[model samples]
Target: MSDKRQQLIETALELFYQEGVQSIGINEVLKVSGVAKKTLYHHFTSKEALVLATLETRNQRFSQWLTVQIAPAKNNQELVEHLFQSLKGWFEDRVEVLGEFRGCFFINTAAEFRDSESEISRYCRQHKSDIKQVIRQQMATYADQPDETLLERICLLKEGVITQAYVAQDMSGPEQAIELLKGR
Candidate 1:
């Protein structure tokens, strides 16, 4: 991507992640990115297009970060533990550029764009499906076959932790997840 386009995407992603997609205007992105309207429009035909690009960018970055966090796991249990630890770090604001825990970006976007058929909502769903797929793949490492029940439980726990951490400002969600995993 060109420097101007990258700048616009980065700025828009930051603003959109910090503020809801509906609330952050294209002008705010352009101003913060130091790019003109013409330039932004040249790269993104519409604000909706820009929103799609921003979400796509975030999805890639978040997935890559999660992959790295779980890369050192020697087994499935360690992989799940590392995943929650990474989330705890995020909730505590330890991840750079992520800023603060405002819940999952895709979840927030999906909530803001309630129309299930919308492109933005589809992207949000795709991001979530991709995360669940990752969890399933990791779970398969320990079992001879994929265990759907365990996968669902872990994914649910992960989602619950994220929601609790974001809504209640409670950083213990991950620890609670760890305890839940212990009983399995």
Candidate 2:
């Protein structure tokens, strides 16, 4: 039998990403997942708990997807190319892990959970930090030293690209980011 907890997370994650945490409710998750409310409650104490679980699962899968997508690069240039190429793939709906681009999930979640001290807000910050760590690790193989400034810029560029792509329906983001990287 399929795990009811995982089913809930997958269903809720899709709904929350497509809509937003504030917009989706527990009843919808139950209906979409076909898991009884009691079963959902058995695994999660509350909807907020379920949201956290969904974010955790998404973060894990996203890190793996990103790592694989950029793993083939041989140099900084290629790393940048691979990064943008991967983003282009996702933007084009080719990245299955991040079905249908809806801006960054963490960004969306953070926007809804504005209290910096809240668990959701903290989780969002941690997710971004982990992504930056991934970038640093990937860049380490090619660079002589860890470049914090470059790391920060890359993170910023990535955020901007996702925003532009999602908010403005601008698909030129990856190319623009690539060109911008070349200037750095």
Candidate 3:
């Protein structure tokens, strides 16, 4: 992507995460991003299009970051541990890949777009499914393959972590998730 387009996405993502997508406007994004209206419209066509681009950009950044965080593992178990530890880091707002924690972007965005059939909500669901797929892939290795049920459990725990951490200001979700992993 061109620098202008990337700048717009980044600026929009930050604002959308800090505020709500419904609360932000195209002019605000352009102003914050320092990109002209013509440039933004030329690149995004519409505000919703820009929002989707930000979601995609966030997904790509998160997936790449998660991949790198789990790279030191020697086995699936260690991989899972690293995954939770990564979340721990994220919860503490220590991870640079994601800036300040403002809850799960997907969750926040989906809440803003309440209609599940809406394009934005659909994209959020797809991003979540993609995250679960990543976890499944991470836990699958030549020596041992985790069952689907276990994968689902872990995914649920991961969601729980994100939700509780954001909703209740609880930061123990990662530890709880790690404990769940230990029981398997």
Better of 1 and 2 by TM-score: 2
| Tens digit per residue, CA lDDT, model 1, 1-184 | 8999999999998899888889999888988999999999899999999999998898888887887787776666787689999999999889985667789998898999868999999999899888888767666666677667767887889989999998888889888888777645
Each candidate: what lDDT? 0.85, 0.89, 0.85
Candidate number with greatest TM-score = 2
Model 3 ranges with Cα > 4 A deviation: none
lDDT of 2: 0.89
Q: Candidate 1 at residue 59, lDDT?
A: 85
Indicate the worst ten consecutive residues by lDDT in candidate 3: 137-146
Per-residue error for 2 in candidate 2, Å, reads 7.0
Best by lDDT: 2
**Angstrom error at residue 133, model 3:** 1.4
Task: Give every collision pair in model 3.
Answer: none
Q: How many backbone clashes does every candidate have?
A: 0, 0, 0
Q: How accurate is candidate 1 locally (lDDT)?
A: 0.85
